[model samples]
Target chain A: MLGRGEIAIVGAAETTQLGAIPGMSQIMLHADAALNAMADAGLKPSDIDGVACVGPMMPQQIAHYLGITPKWVDGTGVGGCSFMLHVRHAAAAIHAGYANTILITHGESGKSRINATPRPPEPESLNGQFEAPFGPFGPPTLFPIPVLRYMKTHGVTHEDLATVAVVQREWAGKNPRAMFRDPITVDDVLNSRMIAYPFRILQCCLVTDGGGALILTKSDRAKDFPTRPVYILGTGESVETNMVSQMADFTSSRAFRVAGPTAIEAAGIDRKDVDHLMIYDAFAHLPLYGLEDLGFCKPGEAAGFIREGNTRPGGKLPLNTNGGGLSYTHTGMYGMFALQESVRQMRGTAPAQVPGAKISVCHGVGGMFSASGTIVFSNERP
Target chain B: MLAPGRAKPKPTPETKHFWDGCKQGKLLLQRCGDTGKAYFPPRPFSPYTGTRNVSVFEASGRATLHSYVIHHRPVPGFTPPYAIAVVELEEGPRMMTNIVECEQTPEALQLDMRLEIAFTPMDEEITLPLFRPAKGGR
Candidate 1:
């Protein structure tokens, strides 16, 4: 597993501003965050030897745009989980002597649609042929199927899901950067206009434009960095069926199950060792699934776990303290922000810092729980 | 406010028969001869065994609702508040479809409710297979 603590994140930063950028294209945001991270690390773009991003051939694009000619590159775009996987892949590449320093960047102009990239509509693709014909707009249309099924089986009430949004908003109140900092109640969530049955507007993430970047190098060389290093204790990534129906089980994400356990096992750490957590909350039910699949709670125990305030601020396990994608900034794929928050918390520099946090776990999902990436980090090496 | 247009699906060689069967008001299941596994959305090779020795058979059109969501957003061609459903077919494979001729509500669209296949013609050459509450519970 490249031995725990082999790689460390030496620099991390998001674009100076988030939300509603009508001028900057998506790629420009990538460059902006990359430059910001470079400045934070006190390293020029030329110092980076590796680059990674989501989608095909993006590593080459971001690297060249940042004025870097990399020896190694990875473009592992598995939906929102892509950046999390990029970190895992970059760490492995570094350990394998493929490169010394790696850069990972994420940028999505989700709301503004400035210079937006259009994905080809493959009508003949399995999902296009089978699922899309049924008239679902997007995740809002499809995700509720699994969640409704989850509710019936697990006895998770509609209000229980609403509580997920309420609690996260309470945390968001402390984050000035959060898009929705106003306090919300469970009634607010339940009464909000329904986008899909079982999902209100409050349960869904906001549409915003943002970008983030990270730099990683061997931990042995990390002390020279300008910021406190967040060592990579372990990472795991996996993918499941693209069509949610084909998911082996609707109530659980197999990708999350695989990735979460692999990371904790590789790190040789138990759940108790985690001082902070970030489970990508693209929707209210996601954190519920993430909690169970990642072994943070027993099956059917997560909804009540949150309702009781276990994950809210001042709770025993403070999760998504950045307010999460639900109340924070969600620039389409939200994994990058989750990782960024984990880095900040581990360094005790988070906007809503978890005091003296030494270890943090960030879990990400892509394409309706179709893919998952889990990473464990620590400010201290075992 | 589902946009007033529906995205059409194009069939490939592997899936042509399934679409053709839909045209004839029949649902088809792809069965792998080697593995005895019947799968949905027909393909050339077995997803489990990777064997190309697959053939199609008529499905009974009986299914039970697995899960569903009532979408209030605008789907091109679909009005607001329609049920998008996944049904477990009698043959055992689940299919993503829509529920027609029933109230799109939690009370009406109960999980594990019995449903039967229904078809909607998109255009002259294309017919979509959907589901509705089955008569007399199977």
Candidate 2:
């Protein structure tokens, strides 16, 4: 849990534009985000001693461009949740006296430039050869399979999945940082061109080119910073089977099942006490599975939960207030945005701030539900 | 002219048997000798006990359609308006397959619909396993 020792987010920063920008390289975007984040925390580049990054366009290149040598560097390539996992690692590193302050950074130009079109390494063994031959290619096709299965088992409809996009778009309309701010309807989603079975164009996330960064430090050190501090109360991470074929349940994510309880317990608070939620929304169905695995809803009930408008604004649970990856800019690194949103909410700086939000939860799912990371945040001390 | 290195389906040794079995109209699953658990996408080691020496067995042709989705768009190699389903075999393993020979609509896809295995050969090297409504349809 996060409360055992003091780890607070003293600063957070993001690039001005999230969509396509042809002028900037990946490293430049990351450097710009890091500078903005450092300014937000009222700190200097020299203050950073540790670095953690997700699957950026070029990690070492970014480090070189920043010119801040970190004593500890973690480049965990588990996809979006990698940033949340980095936060957990940063907290431990700060606690262990390995690094006093850590900067977690991510940047991508996936839309603008196709960097390093290196050939994929040949599968080392026989089993890898079998599955790779099918041309699913990206996450869009891979993730929908389980969601389809979930729909079949629970009698969930495309309309049910469309509701997620519609609600998130509503939030995006309020968020200036979101890529798509226009309001959308269920009919719009249903009528959109189909990419995979049951998943319309609206159900997929955007391929944005953007950057984001977060600064983490010891709790006591955070008090000395210029801004209000948001503490990290608890954190959990788990990995399921890598291959989609080997997953135990297609509809339910094992990472959430394993990490959710550990995170809440570590925070030392009842699940109901958490005031805000930030579940990853790479695909619209992700948050549904996350909520069910985190015990917010029972299995096979998340569809009904969304249909009743519980996750929309003014509803009991206001999810993805920053528009999430669905309507917001995914940048292929949504976990960073989730962490940044929670930190802002806890600091009372969110555009759609929850009234007296003292506790919050942020979750990230990486690599075809192969990995899950959960973190609990609170204003209260243990 | 095209380059020599391009996208092509290649089978690994572990999955080769399963593909071969599909061509032969047999659904093969691995069963752990120690735990007596049936597993899909056969693995050399057991997921339950992490024990080695897992044995392969021919699964009963019978299965129950656990869940499915009606894909309106055509996939890379698949045709338009196909039903992708996850069927739970009688041996207690679930596999991804397509449902055919039925109306591709939600109302027709009832949970726990009894289904039997059907195979569609894509090319000389690959054969995909699909399912269709059993004789006495549910």
Model 2 CAPRI rating: acceptable
Whole-model lDDT per candidate = 0.89, 0.78
Best by DockQ: 1
Clashing pairs in 2: A1-A234, A1-A266, A2-A233, A2-A234, A3-A233, A126-B12, A126-B13, A197-B71
Model 1, B1-138: lDDT tens digits are 123367788999989998998888889898988988889768888988889888899999999999888888765688778888899999889999988889888889889999999977888667888888899853
> Candidate 2 on A1-382: residue-level lDDT in tens?
2345389888898876778877777777777789989999888878888888865444565567787778888887787898888888899988888888898887777688636123242653322343343334467766776776687677888799999999999888888878899999999999988876568889988888888899999898877888888888888999986656457887798888988877888888887787899999988898889889999999889889988998888888888889998888887768888888888888888887877888889999897788989989876656
The CAPRI category of model 1 is: medium
Off by over 4 Å in 2: A1-5, A56-59, A116-137, A155-157, B1-9, B20-26, B69-75, B82-84, B99-111, B119-127, B130-138
Locate the minimum summed-lDDT window of 10 residues in model 2 chain B. Answer: B1-10
Q: Compute the DockQ of candidate 1.
A: 0.80
Give lDDT tens digits, candidate 1, residues A1-382. Answer: 4989999999899988898888788899898888999999999988999999986338888987889989998888788878889999999999999999899998889899887776644788988888888887777776667987899899999999999999989888999999999998889889999988889899999899989999999999999998999999989989998898888788999999999999999988999878898999888999999999999999999999998989988888999999999998998889999999999998889989999898899999998878999999999977
lDDT of 2 at A75: 85
Q: Residue A105 error for model 1, in Å?
A: 0.5
After aligning candidate 2 to the native by TM-score, how far in Å is the CA of B14 from where it should be? Answer: 3.6
Candidate 1, B-chain TM: 0.93
